[model samples]
Target: MRNSRNSKSNKSKSTVMFILVLLIVGALAYTGAFGINNIFGYRVKSFEQAINKGLDLQGGISVLEELQAENIDNETIERTKELLSMRINPEGVKEISITREGSNRIRIEIPGEFDAKKVLETIGKTGKLEFKGPDGKVILTGKDIKNAKAYLDEMSKPTISLDLNQEGTGKFAEGTQKFLGKEIGIYMDGDLLTNPTVQSVITNGKATITGSSSLEEANRKANIIKSGALPVTLEAVEFKTVGATLGANALPLSMKAGAMGIGLVLLFMLIYYRGPGIMASIALVFYVVIVLLAFSVTGVTLTLSGIAGFLLTVGMAVDANVLIFERIKEEMKIGKTIKNATETGFNRALSSILDSNITTIIAGIVLYSLGSGSVKGFALTLMIGIVLSIFTALTVTKFLLKLGTEMGLLSDASHFGVKRG
Candidate 1:
């Protein structure tokens, strides 16, 4: 009778295991990692691939720029970040990070090699794009134009065409008519962008500024126009230029440390929990996969500090499994059946797991609020790791544990590391 009951239980667990494997396989296929794209086609780059590779790893010049602002409040700080992001992007920079530090100070980091003068012009220039009529009268200002793109003219000279909103369109139509045959002046922060003779009256609010001899100059003008027209103005406060080799040294050291830590963890788990520790180690790999997926999907930036936080969470992940296994051993020592002890052990450990993770998450939120720069990076990663750990531990680990028991792998307390007297 007992053998028949065990057979039915084994069949039920096998079905569940099949379903779980199918789900994981399907997910991998959908992501194109193990399907048609992997076998026959080139895979498209995910956003993570486009993510600004930090200067530390890929090699780049890191630039910190300080900006002057009337008010150093949160809104100003955010707008400053946006402006710097826009400013640095044109220099063919690999990665750019802008942050507010003290009450009135801002720090900017630009990765990749850059020319000093070009970098300065990109950030220091106050964009004030404008359109003038043939009569040398102002028709539209940078605020009136929405966006600018660079194109080549008949002689291959670079030109910038502007797109304007409705309000600018109406005003521009009236101005064009009045200034027919006059030169229209384009300016940036009172400096000349271009002064081209107006050839026609444009009523559509779209106009072109031409006569640049080089494409680089034309593109630079377009960027300046885009920056100046922003509703808020930017002042560069601090600038840092880091050589590209910094990451070359740090990355290997970090990888070595992580490997050592994981190795130590595996050794300790095997020594303390025996057979069940091996199972927990297998589950930890799944935990890592789930966490990596979360980071990629959430657009989390993996900084140096972020990696440390992740390693700490990995330790905490093992701690949860250790706690549960310890409790199951206690239950086994009291003479409970393996199945009852497994279930009861997990239940008894649930409150402790929840309480500890919740406290850590709360602490992470506080650190994020109080700290800036790398500290915030650490806090953000810690928060994400803690949340993902809960899901992996509670769902994935629990399912695997139950499956092991039903498969006869963990059929006896002794197999699960309970000492038999």
Candidate 2:
């Protein structure tokens, strides 16, 4: 009777494990198959929409601009970079890279933007902002403005609100008082932004500019106004636009290489370790699904180098399973039952796995912190892959192996690549 009860309990556990694995596979499939528009009534970006491609993968414009100022220090150059990035990518454009190339040059790469001249016009200008009276005399400069924001008025029309400094308040109040019933023109880089007729004296240092065509335009103007003018003038020194054809060609080749690598790894694992290898490969599929989901959710830009890093981490995942399986085989050869060998193997391999993964994680962090462009992208994917690899190896692979043993499918030493002594 006791033996029969034990058999029932083992069967129950195996059933639970099977259901759990099925749920995981179903979730992965649903995520990969569906688009962003429909996902159980909650809108979310799909896998393709979420994983951003870098400039090397998607052709775009690259602009190299030099600061047209003498004796430009690093502080000034950094400030220029910050302001320019704000202008070019105000809404956090994906895969946009801006870096200081030299003491006086800044390089900007915007992927998926085809218009080089328009980008140059937007970022190359000095963006000096001025407020002028009806007589065309300058009343206040961007330096005198304290803050700017985009918002909707009571009428639901987009507007840019401005807050002035104390000195600017005094000047604007006097100018408005004198120019009542006349216009006050706001200009940036010699181009008029808005010319609103003065209605009253604004002694409180607050004013609003209306007549923006859209919310996007109003927000863009507000952002530029808030960032103030570039401390130094920028001149486009070099400009290049990569063709989409080149990027299109490169991606398929990269995908084919990655696919071939993963196929070989799967084949080798299945041939060497038999049943346990099959289980490891299944866990590997889970690892990949989790990693890709993470990338899509986190909006990590995938580049060629990032793909290579991800593939390397796939090998690491295989290595972890190999370590545990080898230890399990050792225990089995010493006359231990399948259950005992599996548990002991996991315990023995835990320390080595933790040490290796932790060290690699540290290295990835360092690279992400210090590296630029594709290097940072690679490091990010590597770090993410390392974390997910550890999870699948410890939880998914172990559970699958235990299920196999409990069901009597993986009990022999030969199934785990060892001969019984």
Candidate 3:
């Protein structure tokens, strides 16, 4: 009966272990860590692809637009900020930063190749909403426009159609009727953006702006229309555009340096920990994958400083594994079974792991709040790395260790660097 009970327990343990491994592996596979591409058709984005590279590594433009102080209320200020973001990111800019500098100013930084003049034109222009008659008659102003959206025509051309309120609709219908066969000029901040001729009476309170345009231009105009009009005008105070050549030079150098650091760290781990070091190395690979996935999912920007943070967290992760291994070795020296030593070592190390991670997280939070630009990037990545490291250390490493013990792979104390009792 006792032999049968032991057999049942071993079977249950095996089943549980198999299920856990499958879950972890399945999750990883679903996340595109194993496949050539993610479940989606697109190639799985790598660490470089997922985390947005910053200005130092990617070489791009950083335009700073400062807002002048006005008697703007909070609601209007928020609305204006939204409008500016829409204009700068019409086709969805990457790693572009738009931050309120002070109570009276805003700072815009776009980290990619972009036309300085074009970006300036976008940032400096006060998105003026306009309404004109079919015959180019001045009918109503942007204040009359309640909402706007973009759609595609039968020919697949992007069309920006807008709706006016009941009062504006009535006025717009009247204007359309009076100015048939004429063009309506839509001016933004006194600059003509679209001029379309009115064909029929638009009594539905809706009008479509049609013109020849590129995909990006259509999207920009649509975004500008959607954001409504800014309460206050803005001017570009500072703009800097970095050449692509400059970014090309920096990217390779940065990658080379980062690779060297990682290689050295891996080398040191192998030398110090031996067999257990290989386990930590495997966990580290998973660590990198988890970190990259987190960044990709969260859209975290990767600057040179962020990479530095990641490297530091790598060391921290290894440190946690080292602590657990050393404790297990000590327990083994006292004649504890391999399973008992492993279990106790993990339990004993839990508090220390939590304490170390909590302290690092607190510092990361403080740095994130106080830092700006690359510093903020570093803090954000560091915080993510620390949290992920804890998961890998506590969960992934523990599971592997348990599996090793069950497989009789680490039956002797010498496997973990301890003398037998």
Candidate 4:
């Protein structure tokens, strides 16, 4: 009578747990990752809305600019690239990419920003660097400076250390002595950047530009100075905008296909593995929610290729469950109890699952490091998915399986797809 009572208690507890799991998973799927709208007059934003989308997905502008200068040097090109990058992506909130193409050409991609003309106006000008005395006489040009970098001085204050060339060393020394107690204006493209009162006269060719609010501001100021030294005119060789409508069409199709694929996988697992399949399906839903949350939190810009990468990970997730279930069946075939078989199966399959996931992760890392644009998006999502899949398979799936076992729901060999002798 007591054993029957315990069985009844277990069944009641299991039913409650099942309902809770279902409701939680359903809520996450409906409102968290996929999102919902206007139930109580508040919009539940989708992950795509929160995270940035790549140029291919959101549609923006692409520009190919080439440096127009005689005897172009690598230093100039690199500095110019840094300047444009900082100028265009000042906030670092936008998915703006500036990459070097060949030796003199730069490819710029701005996602979700349509106007190419405005962007060109921002980056086209050769903001000539100039240092002017109190008498308004030109003292130094950008070419006179050897290097400029921001650093924290002994007092922990952000300072821009400027190194001048041999010719600039002598010129700056005379100017500093002449304007020792006076304000000397630092100008970029005719706009006064700063007018620092010369503190002392030094002939060492090194000077510090101070009075920046933050280290980031100091860095930007240094880049501005280096950029004004741009000896080449940035001519827009090519400029074009991507189509927002085209991306809009493709995104929905990709999402539908992914949903269909996941649905089919869930159905297959249910029909084949029975009890373990039910647990796997729940685990998979949780995996999807976790992955989407990761993307949203990390601000990983998603592209079409990135979506493909995620869909591929869904397959690997199911593969992991399949490995564990097969191992469980093997253990049960030799007369091991369901509980013992589950623990042994997870332990035995751990190595194989890790090996496969690790290898794929390595590949993703390589692609991310070496590839550009869409390739990079694909690699990033693929890596994140694989990592989360391992978590879901080992941690989430195992926990759910153990819970089901404790509830007496996964007690038989037949439940795990094994025929008893």
Residue lDDT tens for model 1, 251-283: 668768986898788888878877677667667
**Model 1 ranges with Cα > 4 A deviation:** 1-38, 43-53, 69-73, 90-94, 134-137, 143-170, 176-226, 229-238
**194, model 2: CA deviation in Å?**
6.4
TM-score for all models, in order of appearance: 0.73, 0.82, 0.75, 0.82
Of the candidates numbered 1 and 4, which has the greater lDDT value?
4
Badly placed stretches (over 4 Å) of model 4 are 1-31, 34-45, 66-80, 101-105, 144-173, 200-222, 231-237
**By the TM-score metric, which is better: model 1 or model 4?**
4
Ranking by TM-score: 2, 4, 3, 1
Candidate 2's TM-score? 0.82
Best by lDDT: 4
lDDT of 2 at 290: 84
Q: Per-residue lDDT tens digits of candidate 2, residues 1-421?
A: 9999998799788968866886887677566646556658887665556688878888898888898989999888887887888778876555688877767888888889998778977886666889898788999898899889899899999999999999999999999999998898888888887788887889999998888988888988888777678888888889899888877988889878876887898899899999998888889878887888888878887888998899989999999998998888888888888889999999999999999999999999999987877788899999999999999999999988878877766867788877765
lDDT of each: 0.71, 0.85, 0.75, 0.87
In model 4, state the lDDT of residue 100.
Answer: 76
Rank order by lDDT, top first? 4, 2, 3, 1
Tens-digit per-residue lDDT, 110-189, candidate 3: 77757778878777675666666544556877777777777678998877878788888988898888878887777766
